[model samples]
Target: MATKRPRRQAVSTCPCGLAETYEGCCGRFHRDEAAAPTAEALMRSRYSAFVRRDEPYLLRTWHPRTRPGRLDLDPGMRWTGLEILATTDGTPFHTTGTVTFRASFRGGTLHERSRFERVDGAWVYVDGDFPAA
Candidate 1:
Protein backbone atom coordinates (compact mmCIF):
# COMPACT_ATOMS: atom_id res chain seq x y z
CA MET A 1 0.00 0.00 0.00
CA ALA A 2 2.66 2.45 1.07
CA THR A 3 0.54 5.52 1.35
CA LYS A 4 0.87 7.40 4.58
CA ARG A 5 2.68 10.64 5.07
CA PRO A 6 0.70 13.33 6.73
CA ARG A 7 0.97 13.90 10.45
CA ARG A 8 3.32 16.78 10.92
CA GLN A 9 1.96 19.99 12.36
CA ALA A 10 3.98 21.76 14.99
CA VAL A 11 6.01 23.79 12.62
CA SER A 12 8.96 26.15 12.86
CA THR A 13 10.05 26.31 16.43
CA CYS A 14 13.04 24.03 16.33
CA PRO A 15 14.75 23.42 13.08
CA CYS A 16 17.53 21.97 15.26
CA GLY A 17 18.96 25.05 16.87
CA LEU A 18 16.87 24.30 19.92
CA ALA A 19 15.25 27.35 21.36
CA GLU A 20 12.18 25.17 21.89
CA THR A 21 9.35 24.89 19.41
CA TYR A 22 8.00 22.39 16.90
CA GLU A 23 5.26 22.09 19.46
CA GLY A 24 7.52 23.02 22.30
CA CYS A 25 10.64 21.37 21.04
CA CYS A 26 10.56 18.15 19.08
CA GLY A 27 6.91 17.87 20.00
CA ARG A 28 7.95 16.14 23.21
CA PHE A 29 9.70 13.45 21.27
CA HIS A 30 6.96 13.20 18.68
CA ARG A 31 4.15 13.27 21.24
CA ASP A 32 5.47 10.55 23.54
CA GLU A 33 5.61 13.49 25.95
CA ALA A 34 9.15 14.26 26.99
CA ALA A 35 12.41 12.42 26.52
CA ALA A 36 15.53 13.87 24.94
CA PRO A 37 16.92 16.38 27.32
CA THR A 38 20.31 16.59 25.77
CA ALA A 39 22.82 15.92 23.00
CA GLU A 40 20.92 18.89 21.79
CA ALA A 41 17.72 16.97 22.27
CA LEU A 42 18.99 14.03 20.33
CA MET A 43 20.37 16.48 17.88
CA ARG A 44 17.00 18.11 17.65
CA SER A 45 15.30 14.84 16.98
CA ARG A 46 17.93 14.02 14.43
CA TYR A 47 17.20 17.28 12.75
CA SER A 48 13.55 16.47 13.06
CA ALA A 49 14.15 13.21 11.30
CA PHE A 50 15.85 15.00 8.49
CA VAL A 51 13.19 17.65 8.26
CA ARG A 52 10.29 15.26 8.26
CA ARG A 53 11.46 12.58 5.98
CA ASP A 54 10.81 10.53 9.12
CA GLU A 55 11.95 7.06 7.98
CA PRO A 56 10.15 5.36 10.83
CA TYR A 57 11.24 8.14 13.06
CA LEU A 58 14.73 7.51 11.97
CA LEU A 59 14.51 3.83 12.74
CA ARG A 60 12.67 4.31 15.99
CA THR A 61 15.15 6.78 17.24
CA TRP A 62 17.97 4.38 16.46
CA HIS A 63 20.47 2.96 18.99
CA PRO A 64 19.75 -0.71 18.53
CA ARG A 65 23.32 -1.85 18.21
CA THR A 66 23.90 1.06 15.92
CA ARG A 67 20.62 0.45 14.14
CA PRO A 68 20.59 -0.33 10.43
CA GLY A 69 18.40 -3.14 9.27
CA ARG A 70 16.84 -1.09 6.52
CA LEU A 71 17.19 2.53 5.61
CA ASP A 72 17.57 4.22 2.26
CA LEU A 73 16.65 7.74 3.39
CA ASP A 74 17.09 9.49 0.10
CA PRO A 75 14.59 12.27 -0.39
CA GLY A 76 16.96 14.87 -1.76
CA MET A 77 19.21 15.42 1.18
CA ARG A 78 18.17 18.71 2.75
CA TRP A 79 19.11 19.36 6.29
CA THR A 80 21.42 22.33 6.31
CA GLY A 81 22.84 23.22 9.68
CA LEU A 82 23.62 22.54 13.35
CA GLU A 83 26.77 22.79 15.40
CA ILE A 84 26.85 21.76 19.06
CA LEU A 85 30.47 20.78 19.36
CA ALA A 86 30.96 19.50 22.93
CA THR A 87 29.23 17.63 25.74
CA THR A 88 29.60 14.64 28.05
CA ASP A 89 27.14 12.69 30.10
CA GLY A 90 26.68 9.38 28.34
CA THR A 91 25.70 6.32 30.31
CA PRO A 92 22.69 7.99 31.85
CA PHE A 93 22.79 11.69 32.16
CA HIS A 94 23.43 13.39 35.45
CA THR A 95 20.10 15.14 35.20
CA THR A 96 20.50 14.39 31.45
CA GLY A 97 23.01 15.50 28.74
CA THR A 98 24.85 15.43 25.32
CA VAL A 99 25.76 17.90 22.58
CA THR A 100 28.52 17.18 20.05
CA PHE A 101 26.85 18.12 16.81
CA ARG A 102 27.72 19.14 13.26
CA ALA A 103 24.91 18.06 10.98
CA SER A 104 24.89 19.73 7.59
CA PHE A 105 23.81 17.22 5.06
CA ARG A 106 23.25 17.48 1.37
CA GLY A 107 25.21 14.99 -0.71
CA GLY A 108 27.60 14.30 2.18
CA THR A 109 28.31 15.98 5.47
CA LEU A 110 28.27 14.23 8.82
CA HIS A 111 30.13 14.72 12.03
CA GLU A 112 28.26 13.46 15.02
CA ARG A 113 29.10 12.42 18.55
CA SER A 114 25.67 11.48 19.72
CA ARG A 115 24.79 9.20 22.63
CA PHE A 116 21.90 9.89 24.89
CA GLU A 117 19.95 7.76 27.33
CA ARG A 118 17.92 8.43 30.38
CA VAL A 119 15.10 5.98 29.76
CA ASP A 120 12.49 5.75 32.52
CA GLY A 121 13.40 9.25 33.47
CA ALA A 122 13.11 10.28 29.80
CA TRP A 123 15.75 11.10 27.17
CA VAL A 124 16.43 8.42 24.55
CA TYR A 125 18.60 7.75 21.48
CA VAL A 126 21.57 6.00 23.03
CA ASP A 127 24.32 5.86 20.40
CA GLY A 128 26.12 7.75 17.63
CA ASP A 129 29.42 9.02 16.22
CA PHE A 130 29.52 9.48 12.47
CA PRO A 131 32.96 10.82 11.99
CA ALA A 132 34.73 9.84 8.79
CA ALA A 133 35.30 12.98 6.85
Candidate 2:
Protein backbone atom coordinates (compact mmCIF):
# COMPACT_ATOMS: atom_id res chain seq x y z
CA MET A 1 0.00 0.00 0.00
CA ALA A 2 1.10 3.56 -0.63
CA THR A 3 0.93 6.33 1.93
CA LYS A 4 -0.99 9.47 1.12
CA ARG A 5 0.60 12.76 1.92
CA PRO A 6 -1.08 15.34 4.13
CA ARG A 7 -2.36 18.48 2.53
CA ARG A 8 -0.12 21.50 2.59
CA GLN A 9 -1.02 24.20 5.07
CA ALA A 10 -2.12 27.46 3.52
CA VAL A 11 0.24 30.38 3.53
CA SER A 12 -0.41 33.87 4.88
CA THR A 13 -0.24 35.98 1.72
CA CYS A 14 -0.78 35.28 -1.95
CA PRO A 15 2.17 35.79 -4.27
CA CYS A 16 -0.09 36.79 -7.17
CA GLY A 17 0.06 40.47 -6.08
CA LEU A 18 -3.46 40.13 -4.66
CA ALA A 19 -4.48 41.48 -1.27
CA GLU A 20 -6.20 38.28 -0.14
CA THR A 21 -4.49 35.58 1.84
CA TYR A 22 -3.29 32.62 -0.19
CA GLU A 23 -6.17 30.37 0.85
CA GLY A 24 -8.78 33.02 0.11
CA CYS A 25 -7.22 33.85 -3.24
CA CYS A 26 -5.27 31.73 -5.70
CA GLY A 27 -5.20 28.66 -3.47
CA ARG A 28 -8.79 27.83 -4.35
CA PHE A 29 -7.95 27.67 -8.04
CA HIS A 30 -4.72 25.79 -7.41
CA ARG A 31 -6.65 23.16 -5.50
CA ASP A 32 -9.32 22.93 -8.20
CA GLU A 33 -11.96 24.16 -5.78
CA ALA A 34 -12.95 26.88 -8.24
CA ALA A 35 -12.21 27.91 -11.81
CA ALA A 36 -10.81 31.36 -12.47
CA PRO A 37 -13.69 33.56 -13.61
CA THR A 38 -11.69 35.70 -16.04
CA ALA A 39 -8.58 35.67 -18.13
CA GLU A 40 -6.79 38.07 -15.84
CA ALA A 41 -7.78 35.98 -12.83
CA LEU A 42 -6.43 32.87 -14.48
CA MET A 43 -3.26 34.71 -15.36
CA ARG A 44 -2.87 35.81 -11.76
CA SER A 45 -3.40 32.28 -10.48
CA ARG A 46 -0.81 30.98 -12.96
CA TYR A 47 1.67 33.53 -11.70
CA SER A 48 0.98 32.39 -8.16
CA ALA A 49 1.50 28.81 -9.29
CA PHE A 50 4.94 29.71 -10.57
CA VAL A 51 5.78 31.44 -7.33
CA ARG A 52 4.68 28.40 -5.32
CA ARG A 53 6.34 26.08 -7.87
CA ASP A 54 3.07 24.26 -8.34
CA GLU A 55 3.94 22.52 -11.60
CA PRO A 56 0.85 20.30 -11.55
CA TYR A 57 -1.47 23.28 -11.33
CA LEU A 58 0.38 24.94 -14.20
CA LEU A 59 0.06 21.84 -16.35
CA ARG A 60 -3.59 21.30 -15.51
CA THR A 61 -4.59 24.83 -16.47
CA TRP A 62 -2.60 24.78 -19.72
CA HIS A 63 -4.35 24.38 -23.06
CA PRO A 64 -3.91 20.95 -24.58
CA ARG A 65 -2.44 22.35 -27.77
CA THR A 66 0.18 24.35 -25.95
CA ARG A 67 0.76 22.44 -22.74
CA PRO A 68 4.23 20.97 -22.58
CA GLY A 69 4.81 17.40 -21.56
CA ARG A 70 6.38 18.63 -18.33
CA LEU A 71 7.79 21.66 -16.67
CA ASP A 72 11.38 22.30 -15.64
CA LEU A 73 11.08 24.97 -13.02
CA ASP A 74 14.19 26.28 -11.41
CA PRO A 75 14.06 25.39 -7.74
CA GLY A 76 16.43 28.21 -6.97
CA MET A 77 14.69 30.91 -8.93
CA ARG A 78 13.03 33.43 -6.64
CA TRP A 79 9.79 34.95 -7.92
CA THR A 80 9.30 38.37 -6.40
CA GLY A 81 6.02 39.90 -7.59
CA LEU A 82 3.57 40.46 -10.45
CA GLU A 83 2.04 43.48 -12.15
CA ILE A 84 -1.05 43.23 -14.37
CA LEU A 85 -0.68 45.82 -17.08
CA ALA A 86 -3.65 45.11 -19.38
CA THR A 87 -6.41 42.73 -20.39
CA THR A 88 -8.73 42.11 -23.33
CA ASP A 89 -12.03 40.26 -23.68
CA GLY A 90 -11.31 37.77 -20.93
CA THR A 91 -14.63 37.65 -19.16
CA PRO A 92 -17.33 35.09 -18.45
CA PHE A 93 -19.17 36.30 -21.54
CA HIS A 94 -16.13 35.83 -23.77
CA THR A 95 -14.57 32.55 -24.84
CA THR A 96 -11.13 34.00 -25.53
CA GLY A 97 -8.97 36.57 -23.83
CA THR A 98 -5.52 38.03 -23.31
CA VAL A 99 -3.59 39.28 -20.30
CA THR A 100 -0.48 41.42 -20.36
CA PHE A 101 1.71 41.55 -17.29
CA ARG A 102 5.16 41.75 -15.81
CA ALA A 103 6.42 39.12 -13.42
CA SER A 104 9.48 40.06 -11.43
CA PHE A 105 11.96 37.64 -10.09
CA ARG A 106 15.09 38.11 -8.04
CA GLY A 107 17.25 39.12 -10.99
CA GLY A 108 14.83 40.58 -13.56
CA THR A 109 11.30 40.90 -14.91
CA LEU A 110 9.31 38.94 -17.47
CA HIS A 111 6.93 40.95 -19.61
CA GLU A 112 4.41 38.98 -21.59
CA ARG A 113 1.08 39.12 -23.34
CA SER A 114 -0.53 35.76 -22.67
CA ARG A 115 -3.35 34.28 -24.71
CA PHE A 116 -6.08 32.09 -23.27
CA GLU A 117 -9.04 30.06 -24.49
CA ARG A 118 -12.06 28.29 -23.03
CA VAL A 119 -11.79 24.51 -23.20
CA ASP A 120 -14.79 22.48 -22.09
CA GLY A 121 -16.09 25.52 -20.22
CA ALA A 122 -12.80 26.16 -18.40
CA TRP A 123 -10.11 28.68 -19.15
CA VAL A 124 -6.73 27.31 -20.18
CA TYR A 125 -3.46 28.97 -21.01
CA VAL A 126 -2.67 28.84 -24.73
CA ASP A 127 0.71 30.57 -24.99
CA GLY A 128 2.42 33.92 -24.55
CA ASP A 129 4.58 36.41 -26.38
CA PHE A 130 7.42 38.28 -24.76
CA PRO A 131 7.12 41.93 -25.55
CA ALA A 132 10.13 43.85 -26.73
CA ALA A 133 12.04 45.77 -24.12
Candidate 3:
Protein backbone atom coordinates (compact mmCIF):
# COMPACT_ATOMS: atom_id res chain seq x y z
CA MET A 1 0.00 0.00 0.00
CA ALA A 2 1.28 3.52 -0.84
CA THR A 3 1.38 6.00 1.99
CA LYS A 4 -0.16 9.47 1.64
CA ARG A 5 2.26 12.34 1.17
CA PRO A 6 1.99 15.74 2.72
CA ARG A 7 0.93 18.47 0.32
CA ARG A 8 3.14 21.46 -0.27
CA GLN A 9 1.57 24.80 0.55
CA ALA A 10 1.72 27.26 -2.33
CA VAL A 11 2.91 30.78 -1.61
CA SER A 12 0.72 33.37 -3.28
CA THR A 13 2.65 36.59 -2.73
CA CYS A 14 6.36 37.15 -2.97
CA PRO A 15 8.32 38.09 0.13
CA CYS A 16 9.61 41.24 -1.60
CA GLY A 17 6.17 42.89 -1.47
CA LEU A 18 5.43 42.06 -5.10
CA ALA A 19 1.92 41.01 -6.18
CA GLU A 20 3.17 38.00 -8.15
CA THR A 21 3.80 34.56 -6.70
CA TYR A 22 7.26 33.71 -5.35
CA GLU A 23 8.04 31.27 -8.15
CA GLY A 24 7.34 33.89 -10.80
CA CYS A 25 9.06 36.74 -9.00
CA CYS A 26 12.24 36.51 -6.97
CA GLY A 27 12.33 32.75 -7.13
CA ARG A 28 13.18 32.91 -10.80
CA PHE A 29 16.14 35.17 -10.09
CA HIS A 30 17.17 33.03 -7.15
CA ARG A 31 17.14 29.97 -9.39
CA ASP A 32 19.46 31.75 -11.88
CA GLU A 33 16.83 31.52 -14.61
CA ALA A 34 17.17 35.26 -15.20
CA ALA A 35 19.17 38.26 -14.06
CA ALA A 36 17.64 41.37 -12.54
CA PRO A 37 17.46 44.02 -15.25
CA THR A 38 17.49 47.01 -12.92
CA ALA A 39 19.13 47.90 -9.66
CA GLU A 40 15.79 48.03 -7.87
CA ALA A 41 15.00 44.56 -9.15
CA LEU A 42 18.31 43.29 -7.83
CA MET A 43 17.65 44.98 -4.50
CA ARG A 44 14.23 43.37 -4.26
CA SER A 45 15.66 39.96 -5.11
CA ARG A 46 18.39 40.40 -2.47
CA TYR A 47 15.75 41.20 0.12
CA SER A 48 13.88 38.05 -0.82
CA ALA A 49 17.13 36.13 -0.53
CA PHE A 50 17.59 37.38 3.01
CA VAL A 51 14.02 36.42 3.86
CA ARG A 52 14.59 32.92 2.51
CA ARG A 53 18.14 32.65 3.95
CA ASP A 54 19.59 32.08 0.51
CA GLU A 55 23.20 32.97 1.26
CA PRO A 56 24.63 31.66 -1.98
CA TYR A 57 22.34 33.84 -4.05
CA LEU A 58 23.28 36.81 -1.94
CA LEU A 59 26.99 36.19 -2.36
CA ARG A 60 26.68 35.44 -6.04
CA THR A 61 24.94 38.74 -6.70
CA TRP A 62 27.38 40.81 -4.65
CA HIS A 63 30.18 42.74 -6.25
CA PRO A 64 33.45 40.89 -6.09
CA ARG A 65 35.26 43.90 -4.70
CA THR A 66 32.86 44.05 -1.78
CA ARG A 67 31.56 40.51 -1.54
CA PRO A 68 32.24 38.87 1.79
CA GLY A 69 33.82 35.49 2.13
CA ARG A 70 30.68 34.09 3.71
CA LEU A 71 27.34 35.05 5.18
CA ASP A 72 26.20 34.41 8.74
CA LEU A 73 22.42 34.58 8.74
CA ASP A 74 20.66 34.23 12.04
CA PRO A 75 18.38 31.20 12.05
CA GLY A 76 16.13 32.75 14.67
CA MET A 77 15.47 35.93 12.77
CA ARG A 78 12.02 36.15 11.17
CA TRP A 79 11.74 38.59 8.28
CA THR A 80 8.39 40.34 8.05
CA GLY A 81 8.40 42.67 5.04
CA LEU A 82 10.34 44.86 2.60
CA GLU A 83 9.54 48.44 1.61
CA ILE A 84 11.42 50.35 -1.07
CA LEU A 85 11.46 54.06 -0.42
CA ALA A 86 13.55 55.43 -3.29
CA THR A 87 15.74 54.55 -6.25
CA THR A 88 18.39 56.52 -8.12
CA ASP A 89 19.74 55.54 -11.51
CA GLY A 90 20.25 51.78 -11.42
CA THR A 91 18.31 51.21 -14.60
CA PRO A 92 19.57 49.43 -17.71
CA PHE A 93 20.87 52.67 -19.11
CA HIS A 94 23.01 53.42 -16.05
CA THR A 95 26.04 51.55 -14.81
CA THR A 96 25.38 52.28 -11.13
CA GLY A 97 22.38 52.86 -8.87
CA THR A 98 21.12 53.16 -5.35
CA VAL A 99 18.04 51.72 -3.64
CA THR A 100 16.86 52.99 -0.30
CA PHE A 101 14.65 50.55 1.55
CA ARG A 102 13.34 49.32 4.85
CA ALA A 103 13.40 45.66 5.73
CA SER A 104 11.34 44.69 8.75
CA PHE A 105 11.91 41.69 10.92
CA ARG A 106 9.99 40.33 13.89
CA GLY A 107 11.47 42.89 16.27
CA GLY A 108 12.58 45.91 14.27
CA THR A 109 13.18 47.47 10.87
CA LEU A 110 16.46 48.05 9.04
CA HIS A 111 16.73 51.11 6.83
CA GLU A 112 19.51 51.38 4.29
CA ARG A 113 20.56 52.95 1.03
CA SER A 114 22.14 50.17 -0.95
CA ARG A 115 24.45 50.62 -3.92
CA PHE A 116 24.55 48.56 -7.10
CA GLU A 117 26.67 48.37 -10.20
CA ARG A 118 26.77 46.51 -13.48
CA VAL A 119 29.47 43.90 -13.91
CA ASP A 120 29.61 42.03 -17.18
CA GLY A 121 26.15 43.37 -18.05
CA ALA A 122 24.59 42.04 -14.86
CA TRP A 123 23.44 44.05 -11.88
CA VAL A 124 25.36 43.28 -8.71
CA TYR A 125 25.13 44.63 -5.17
CA VAL A 126 28.07 46.63 -3.89
CA ASP A 127 27.40 48.01 -0.40
CA GLY A 128 24.96 49.94 1.73
CA ASP A 129 24.83 52.80 4.19
CA PHE A 130 22.59 52.98 7.26
CA PRO A 131 21.16 56.38 7.92
CA ALA A 132 21.32 57.84 11.40
CA ALA A 133 18.08 57.51 13.37
Candidate 4:
Protein backbone atom coordinates (compact mmCIF):
# COMPACT_ATOMS: atom_id res chain seq x y z
CA MET A 1 0.00 0.00 0.00
CA ALA A 2 1.19 3.53 -0.76
CA THR A 3 1.44 6.07 2.04
CA LYS A 4 -0.73 9.16 1.83
CA ARG A 5 0.90 12.58 1.85
CA PRO A 6 -0.56 15.50 3.73
CA ARG A 7 -1.87 18.38 1.67
CA ARG A 8 -0.12 21.75 1.91
CA GLN A 9 -2.19 24.41 3.59
CA ALA A 10 -2.49 27.93 2.24
CA VAL A 11 -0.58 30.70 3.98
CA SER A 12 -2.73 33.06 5.99
CA THR A 13 -0.12 35.28 7.58
CA CYS A 14 1.00 38.43 5.86
CA PRO A 15 4.49 38.19 4.42
CA CYS A 16 5.35 41.60 5.83
CA GLY A 17 4.99 40.15 9.37
CA LEU A 18 2.83 43.02 10.58
CA ALA A 19 -0.66 41.63 10.08
CA GLU A 20 -2.46 38.53 11.30
CA THR A 21 -3.55 37.55 7.80
CA TYR A 22 -2.83 38.44 4.22
CA GLU A 23 -6.37 39.61 3.54
CA GLY A 24 -6.36 42.06 6.45
CA CYS A 25 -3.03 43.43 5.34
CA CYS A 26 -1.18 43.36 2.02
CA GLY A 27 -3.90 41.46 0.24
CA ARG A 28 -6.14 44.51 0.46
CA PHE A 29 -3.62 46.56 -1.45
CA HIS A 30 -2.82 43.77 -3.91
CA ARG A 31 -6.49 43.29 -4.67
CA ASP A 32 -7.08 47.01 -5.27
CA GLU A 33 -9.41 47.27 -2.33
CA ALA A 34 -7.24 49.93 -0.67
CA ALA A 35 -4.10 51.96 -1.10
CA ALA A 36 -1.26 52.12 1.38
CA PRO A 37 -1.68 55.21 3.54
CA THR A 38 1.95 55.54 4.51
CA ALA A 39 5.44 54.75 3.35
CA GLU A 40 5.79 51.92 5.85
CA ALA A 41 2.57 50.39 4.63
CA LEU A 42 3.73 50.60 1.04
CA MET A 43 7.05 49.02 1.97
CA ARG A 44 5.30 46.20 3.76
CA SER A 45 2.98 45.64 0.82
CA ARG A 46 5.96 45.58 -1.55
CA TYR A 47 7.57 42.89 0.58
CA SER A 48 4.38 40.90 0.44
CA ALA A 49 4.36 41.31 -3.34
CA PHE A 50 7.84 39.79 -3.50
CA VAL A 51 6.64 36.81 -1.51
CA ARG A 52 3.67 36.36 -3.81
CA ARG A 53 5.73 37.03 -6.95
CA ASP A 54 3.26 39.73 -7.96
CA GLU A 55 5.46 41.68 -10.32
CA PRO A 56 2.60 43.83 -11.58
CA TYR A 57 1.74 45.05 -8.11
CA LEU A 58 5.37 45.85 -7.43
CA LEU A 59 5.71 47.78 -10.65
CA ARG A 60 2.44 49.63 -10.14
CA THR A 61 3.56 50.90 -6.74
CA TRP A 62 7.05 51.84 -7.83
CA HIS A 63 7.84 55.43 -8.78
CA PRO A 64 8.01 55.83 -12.51
CA ARG A 65 11.35 57.63 -12.36
CA THR A 66 13.16 54.66 -10.91
CA ARG A 67 10.81 51.81 -11.72
CA PRO A 68 12.10 49.22 -14.13
CA GLY A 69 10.16 48.46 -17.27
CA ARG A 70 10.12 44.81 -16.28
CA LEU A 71 10.83 42.86 -13.10
CA ASP A 72 12.58 39.50 -13.22
CA LEU A 73 11.99 37.77 -9.92
CA ASP A 74 14.21 34.83 -9.10
CA PRO A 75 12.25 31.59 -8.86
CA GLY A 76 14.69 30.19 -6.32
CA MET A 77 14.31 33.11 -3.95
CA ARG A 78 11.87 32.67 -1.10
CA TRP A 79 11.12 35.51 1.30
CA THR A 80 10.90 34.34 4.89
CA GLY A 81 10.40 37.47 7.02
CA LEU A 82 10.49 41.26 7.37
CA GLU A 83 11.64 43.57 10.16
CA ILE A 84 11.07 47.32 10.05
CA LEU A 85 13.77 49.25 11.90
CA ALA A 86 12.82 52.90 11.44
CA THR A 87 10.68 55.42 9.55
CA THR A 88 11.10 59.12 8.77
CA ASP A 89 8.61 61.72 7.57
CA GLY A 90 6.17 59.28 5.95
CA THR A 91 3.03 60.96 7.17
CA PRO A 92 0.13 62.06 5.02
CA PHE A 93 1.43 65.63 5.16
CA HIS A 94 4.85 64.63 3.99
CA THR A 95 5.80 64.36 0.31
CA THR A 96 8.96 62.31 0.79
CA GLY A 97 9.91 59.65 3.32
CA THR A 98 12.24 56.84 4.19
CA VAL A 99 11.82 53.39 5.71
CA THR A 100 14.64 51.22 6.98
CA PHE A 101 14.06 47.49 7.19
CA ARG A 102 15.49 44.01 7.00
CA ALA A 103 13.94 41.40 4.70
CA SER A 104 15.01 37.81 5.24
CA PHE A 105 15.05 35.34 2.36
CA ARG A 106 15.79 31.63 2.16
CA GLY A 107 19.56 31.94 2.31
CA GLY A 108 20.24 35.63 3.08
CA THR A 109 18.92 38.88 4.49
CA LEU A 110 18.64 42.34 2.92
CA HIS A 111 18.97 45.47 5.00
CA GLU A 112 17.92 48.63 3.24
CA ARG A 113 16.80 52.19 3.78
CA SER A 114 14.14 52.79 1.18
CA ARG A 115 12.90 56.12 -0.10
CA PHE A 116 9.32 56.94 -1.01
CA GLU A 117 7.38 59.86 -2.36
CA ARG A 118 3.75 60.84 -2.52
CA VAL A 119 2.65 61.28 -6.11
CA ASP A 120 -0.96 62.26 -6.82
CA GLY A 121 -1.72 61.50 -3.17
CA ALA A 122 -0.38 57.95 -3.48
CA TRP A 123 2.80 56.66 -1.93
CA VAL A 124 5.31 55.15 -4.34
CA TYR A 125 8.70 53.53 -3.83
CA VAL A 126 11.54 55.53 -5.34
CA ASP A 127 14.75 53.73 -4.46
CA GLY A 128 16.66 51.94 -1.69
CA ASP A 129 20.16 51.83 -0.31
CA PHE A 130 21.57 48.68 1.23
CA PRO A 131 23.46 48.86 4.48
CA ALA A 132 27.00 47.57 4.68
CA ALA A 133 27.06 43.85 5.33
Highest lDDT: give the candidate number.
3
Question: Could you give candidate 4's per-residue lDDT for residues 1-133 as a string of tens digits?
Answer: 9999998887678888975789999999999899999999999999999999999999999999999999999989999999999999998889999999999998889999999999899999999999785
RMSD of each: 14.2, 7.6, 3.8, 4.1
Residue 52 lDDT in model 2?
Answer: 91
In candidate 2, what are the lDDT values of residues 1-133, reduced to their tens digit?
A: 9999999986678889888998989999999999999999999999999999999999999999989999999999999999999999999999999999999999999999999999999999999999996
TM-score of 4: 0.89
TM-score of each: 0.29, 0.90, 0.91, 0.89
**Scored by CA lDDT, what does every candidate get?**
0.69, 0.95, 0.96, 0.94
Cα lDDT tens digits for candidate 3, 1-133: 9999999987679999989999999999999999999999999999999999999999999999999999999999999999999999999999999999999999999999999999999999999999875
Clashing pairs in 1: 21-25, 35-123, 36-123, 39-98
List the candidates ranked by lDDT, beginning with the highest. 3, 2, 4, 1
- Model 3's TM-score against the true structure: 0.91
Residue 53 lDDT, candidate 1, scale 0-100:
77
Winner of 2 and 4 under TM-score = 2
Which candidate tops TM-score?
Answer: 3
Error of 1 at 108 (Å): 10
Q: Which stretches of candidate 1 lie over 4 Å from their true place?
A: 1-41, 44-48, 55-84, 107-120, 124-133
What lDDT, from 0 to 1, does candidate 4 have?
Answer: 0.94
